[model samples]
Structures are given as C-alpha cells and as structure tokens.
Target: MLESYSRCWTEIDYAAIAHNVEEIQKLVGDTKIMGIVKANAYGHGDVECAKALQKVGVDFFGVSSVDEALHLRQNGIHDSILILGYTPPEHFHYLIEENIIQSLVSYDYAQKLDAYAKEAGTKIRCHCKVDTGMCRTGVIYQVQEKNMDQILAEYRMEHLIVEGIFSHFPVSDDLGQESAAFTKKQIELFEEVCDNLRKEGINPGIRHIQNSYGILNYGDLKMDYCRPGLLYMGVTSDDAIPIASKPDFIPILSWYANVSLVKWIQKGQSVSYGRHFIATKPTKVATVSVGYADGLHRLVSNCGLEVLIHGQKCPIIGNVCMDQCMVDVTQVDDVKEGDVVVLVGRQGDHRVTIDEISRKSHSINNETLSDIAGRVPRLRRREK
Candidate 1:
C-alpha cells in the first residue's frame, strides 16, 4: 500500500521531461541546452529533477548559488554545473575546487578569480556576462565594449580560461515590435563583443543568448547554446505567441491531497478565516490537509481556482488557511472522507494547471511552482 503521506504528494512524470527536452532540442538544433535547475528545479525537487533531466541528455545544469550546486553534487550529479548568479569573491577557491563554472560580471572580480586560479595552479573556466540592457546582472553594455576587452586582454592571467560569453533578454515575453527591436539590439551587441574578442586573438566559447521565451519566439537568437528555464516545466511565457509545431508538453508536477474531513455546513454559516464565504444554501464542505504554508498562494482564496473531487471540479470556499483549506463539494455527491482531491494536474478529463493558479494569484508560473516547499513529498511516477 502507498504510504499515508503519499496522499498529499507531488507526482513527477519523467517521460514528460524527456519529451520537453526533445522538443527544445529540435527547436534549437545542434545548440547545447543548459537546463536551468536553479531554485530546486523551480520547486519541482532539485536533485530528482536534475537527475531526470540528465537522463534525458541535458548538456549542463544551471543553478544560482554554490549551495545549490553542492546539493546537486551531493546527489551524485557530476555534470558541468554553472553558477549563473553572483558568487562572492571569497567563494572563488571553493568554485575552483568543485570544477563548477562561474559567471564573472566585473573586471575586478575577474582579476580576483585570476589571482586565485594562479595560486591554485589551474585554469578556472569562467563565462563573461554582458548586460545588454537587462540592468539586472552582468556588465552594463555601454561599458562592456571597452571593459570586456581590457578584462580579456590585460586583466586575464594565464590560469584563467574564458569559456563562454552570454547575455539575457529582459522582456522576451513582451511580444511587441519594440521588444523585438530591443532583443535584436542585445543580440547584435553580443555578436559584436564576440567579434572583437576574436580580433584580439581570444576565442570565448559557447556564445549564447536565448532564454526560454527567446528560444520559442526568436529562432534567430538561438546561437551556439540556449539556456532554457521555465520551458522545461512546460510553462510558456506568453499564450499569444504560438508554439504550434513543437512536441506537446506534459506538466511534470501534480499537487494532490486527501480529504481529511467531510461534513455539512449549515446555511448562513461561514467558512475559514475572516468568514469570507457564507453558505446561502446548505453546503457540503471537505477540509483538505494542505494550505498556503504548503505553497498554495493565499491569493487563491475565494478566487477562480478549483480542485477535482471525484473527477468533478469543485469551488474552493473561504480563505485558504496556513495548513488547511475547505472546498465546497456540494455537487460531488459521492465525495467523502479519504477521497482524493487534485489541486494541480489532471483528474479524469478535468485538469488544473499552474498557469491557471498563476493567473488567479496575479503571479508568475515560475514562482508558483518553485515556491512549493519541502513539506510536500514528491512521488516519482513509474513508467507505464
């Protein structure tokens, strides 16, 4: 028998992962894919997601922190791990020893890394990040032309190897022509930087610029490599931008919980905190043992969100509690204690997607998935 804890669990479909990888691979043919598994595979269970992605032939694992990389290493994930976020200078030695790739955004930081690599007597593989107008991370574009050249020419020591050059698209989701123009500008600037480096007798390998949105909408920007994060989880940036010819994606994660209690709430009685829901008619309410604390956004309270109870969609009543939520199962006549309720994922012909939740919560799909905490046990789905 399945453990009781499995009643409230996440089911990850490995085959879906393979399908998504093949789809993206076809989209960016011959270019390598750096599967962004940062934020614990965007809250889909990091070690397991990385393992599944590696099985599907992901070329590299991208993470945000040293600790995240170490977690992958601890799980026996030995593939090339790239720490895309800023790593403190003090942690350079640790990055060097782990054989993990790091992104350098500043010349001074690059020099610090060079000094450490020289002391260690080994060449450190590092990628140079050009801002290209993101204004978030990386070296700003206006200064990059001169500063990048100096970093590669003067600041670079014998022990530091320039492995890759990349930039990010700030508004790939905004499909307006202006957004396209800006993206084109960034890509052009990145290409010019590469050209300049080559002219100076320095070849920084793996020039990449396409992100998840860029990979789908802008085929022209898919260069030597593509970094795809959210697409791996079957989330598209914009519904208006059609991805018609690609392989169909299956959402890998499913959220489910069993009914802890089933009873009748008298007419006029309210449910949950703040008495947000009042029963005009007698209501059959079922309490499920999972709530906002478990990563269900509080915004889902009394909104358009619905869950499948006995394969029928039921409205969520009142405010969702920190550890529990009540759903009006009035129409699901057969629902009782111990019946299964699926908050996210398929149930019969009905389904609830993270996209739906995101729309209701006025939040991004990436945040919705990644915020599902350690409290939820992820059950690995077996092959049929």
Candidate 2:
C-alpha cells in the first residue's frame, strides 16, 4: 500500500514537463527560454525539474538568489543561470566562482558590484534590469538622456559584463484596455531604452521583457529570451484573467497522501479540533496522513475541500490538524487504511487541481504549489 511507503508524496511527470516545454517552444519559436526554477522550481523539486528541463533543450535557467544558483550548480546543472533577484555584496565572489549571472538592479548597486569585482580582479556577467513600470527594481525607465546615461554607465564598467537588459510586466496578464495600454507602454519604454543603447553603440547583450504572461499575450515582440516560471510548470492561477491565446500546457505535478485510519462515528459525535463537525447520523471518518504542515492550508478546514478515495470525492471534515485531517468517506465503498488519497491530482474520472486548492484556500496557484513542504518527498515519474 502507498501508506506503507510514505504518508504523503508528490509525483512529478517529467514527460509532462517536457511536453510543456515543447508547447512553449512552439509558441516562442527560436527565442531561447530561461526556465525559471527558483523556489525549488515552485516546489516541484529544483534538481529534478532542472534535469528534466536540461534534457528537453532549455539552455538557460533563472533563479532568485545566488544560493539557488549554487544549489543548481552543485546538483550538476551546467546551464547558464541568471539570478533574477538581489544578492548581497559579500557573496559576489560566489557568483563569479559559480559562473552565475547577476541582475543589476540599479546604478548604485551596479557600482558596488563592479567595485567588488574589480577588487577581486574578475568581471561578472550581468543583465541590467530597467524598471519600465513595475517600479520595483532596476534603473527607472525614462526616455530622457539621464536614463540612458545611468544604463550606459553599467555597460562601460570595466569589471562588469552587461550582457543583457530586461524588465518585468505588472499587468501583462490582463487583457483589459487600461491594463493592456499600461503593458504596451512598458514594452515601448523598454524597447526605447534598448534602442537608445544600441544607437549609442552598446550591444545591450540580450533583451528579454516577457514573463509567463508576457509570453502568452505579447510573444510577437522580438526579444533574445523569454522567462516562463508558472507557465513552464503547466498551471496558472484560478483567477487568472483570459489571455490572447491559451496554449495547451500539461500539468506536471500531482499530490497524494495515504489513509491512516478509518472509523465509524455515532450520531452527535464530533470530529477533530473545535467540534466543527457533528454527525447527524452514523458517519464514517477517515484520517488522512497530511495536513497544514504538509502545505495544505489550514484555512481550507471545513471549507468544502474534497479529496479522492477509491475514485470518489470525500468531503474534508472538521479542522485540519498539523499532521492529519479527517475526511467523510461514508460514500466511498470499502474504505480502508492504506488506501491512496488524491490531494491535487486525478483519480479515475475526477480531478482536483492546484488552482482548486488555491481558490478554496484563498491563495494563488504559485503560493499553493510553492507552499508544499520540503518534508514531503517529490518522486519523479515518466508517462508512457
């Protein structure tokens, strides 16, 4: 039985990951894909997913920090990795040692990193981020000469190799007129920055502005690379707005647990903490070996969340505990301990998705998937 081996586990379909990459390749054509594998590949297992992605011809990877980049490197991932977030100055040497690219967030940050690289007698590869509208990081985008001057300074730094320039979209996923206009302006401003740099005789290395949403909506834009984080994982938020053209991306991960115990309760008996559920008549309750500690949100308790047992949807009863939750499995035929329980995946003709769990938990798909704890093992599988 599944319970005999593991209380809970995540099954990753490598074939599905490959399929999603192939679908994305078809959409973007020759534009290289920087497979975003940060946050443990959105909790899908970074090493495993990176290996799978590398096998499928993805030549670049994007991570959040130097540590994540090193994690990939230590795990034998030799692809070019770009850190899309901040890295402390003290760790600048690790970036050079590991041959990882850093995102130059601002002119001041660039100065500091360059100074450090100069002191170490080495040049660090970087991608300059232009704050085209998100207003989070990078040199603020302006068509004026001052904006160009700051960007140009990074390219001229002797210790820094400014190989690429990129920006992010705050609302490229939204097709609404207001949002579309904002997205369009962001693209235009980013392009203007790159064009201005080129006119100044700066190669600007590689220019990428599309994220997962950007690839779906504005893929026609010419860019050197496209960074697909969630799209590459084959799932989007449940509340995600409609896009121009939705690709047929296959989901790559499924969650499962095991039935730990089953019992019959008499009328008026309460189950779990807070006595939230009272049996009107005789009811059969099954304890599942997974809970909030396993990344199942506590807010989902008694919130109409269902699990699958013997291919039947069973309502989760009472409050979810740290390591276990109760399910009303009376309708399931011959429910027994050690039976497989599908938490976020298919069971017979029924399926529960990450978006479903996100909706019920009042969270987004990324948070829902990335919240899955590391304690639960991620086992790789290949479809026939």
Best by lDDT: 2
What's the TM for model 2? 0.96
lDDT by residue for model 2 (1-384), tens: 123348989888866888888878777878888899999999998888888888888889999999999999999998899999999998998988999999998999999999999999999999999988888889988544237789999999999999899999989889999999999988889888878888988898888989988988888886889999888789875545688876899888889999999999999999999999999999999999999999999999998999989998999999999999999998888998889999988889998888878988889888999999999988776456
RMSD of each: 2.2, 1.8
Measured against the true structure, the TM-scores of the candidates, in listed sequence, are 0.93, 0.96
Off by over 4 Å in 1: 1-4, 142-146, 150-155, 237-247
Where model 2 places Cα greater than 4 Å from the true spot, the runs are 1-4, 142-146
- Tens digit of per-residue lDDT, candidate 1, span 1-384: 133465477877756788888888877888888889999888877788787788877868889998898888888989988888878877777787788888876666777778888887888888888788787777666534445655464225677777887888887666688987887788777887788778878786878888888787675555888988877777664343554245466677788888999999898999999998999999999999788888888999999589988888998889989888999988887777788888888888898887777878888888888778788887877667
lDDT of each: 0.79, 0.88
